[model samples]
Target: MKKTIVLVTLFIMPIVVYLFFASGITNFGKLAMLTHDVSEIDFADSNVALADKITVLGFLGSDVSNKKGNAFNLNQKIYKRFGQFKDFQFVMVMPKGTEQSVDDLKAQLGQLSDVSKWNFVFGEEDQIKGLFNSLGTNLSLDANLGTPYVFIIDKERILRGRDDDEDEGVKYGFDTSSVADLNNKMEDDIKIILAEYRMALKKNTAQREK
Candidate 1:
């Protein structure tokens, strides 16, 4: 009777463990690490606080004359989903004096939601390029034609890449590619990162309580 019970328990435990993972009960993956740190940006004309914001950053300069790109619509969707978080922002880094163009672009896109959360910051060419380099992205100010890659930055100024820390999808260098399934996949990463931040906060709070 004892031998039969032990065999049954062993068989059931493996199946239970497999089902737990298969049912998405556990996410063993870690959140994406910061590829690089960003510096204090010299805003063109806004006083928006840089700290404590989850920013989706993009570039628009003489090289990137137009504001329309793959990131714009994706950002709108993200804002609709997560803008109520208050600290979330979509930052468009453009050249000084192109604020009008950005506004026009926003209007063109129908301004679906989170208009206040969309920050259009402008700076000189050199300042914008330097900021991009500091973030460890392979963006260029000299390229006449290139795709503006979007970056997800956390409150602590670390660049959050695709998925979690160990995933190969993380961007390490200059990448002009955009995700084909931009909305759903990137949104999932953003949620995971947000959850990670919240978990850290809870852990810190618990420590303080003790």
Candidate 2:
């Protein structure tokens, strides 16, 4: 009888673990479904219009304790380099539970004079998760969870590059190196997108002259 009881316990443990992790993945997929295009979202400040061309949006998960992570540095560098592109906009979305407030974030960004050329958006945890989901990226839902993610969206609303951290259609299995390579490739991809936008802008301008 004891042997039977032990066998039953062993059989049930793996099932329980699988279900727990599976549920978390499902929840993330649901959250991702809530994301809408940036053009669809109304920016509180009208001076910064919705990008009509290619846009690069980076997600930085900042904590009050450590404000200088690689994510922050990457954003600062990108802003300093390309913040002035008329057809390209760089947006940084902060994770939830960060010590910084929207105003505080703005103030911190103010230290970088070039930062004024771009827009800084304060994102709610759920909304940001939805954006990740829309890009097909999965982020931890916990209050303090953060991930470094970059997304490139074209004017036609097409999402280019791998969005989710997980392998497509597979649950829980992640390729860390693949994600890192994708992030690195984003800088080059952004340049290509910007060039396309510039060409389109030139075409539009020439047509208007005619």
Specify the highest-lDDT model's number: 1
Best prediction by TM-score: 1
lDDT of each: 0.62, 0.50
The digit string of per-residue lDDT tens for model 2 on 49-111 reads 334655556555556334344434554555555566766665556654453554565566667
Could you tell me which 10 consecutive residues in candidate 2 have the lowest summed lDDT?
Answer: 170-179
Error of 2 at 22 (Å): 46
What value does the lDDT take at residue 73 in candidate 2? 56
Can you write out model 1's per-residue Cα lDDT over 1-210, one digit (the tens) per residue? 999989879998878745533332134344456565687676556776456887777765544335366545565556676776657887777776666766677775555654777777878767777777877654454452224566778888888764332435545322223444454355555666666666678799999999
* Ten-residue stretch with the least lDDT total in model 1: 20-29
Over 4 Å off, model 2: 1-39, 42-53, 62-67, 95-109, 138-145, 162-184
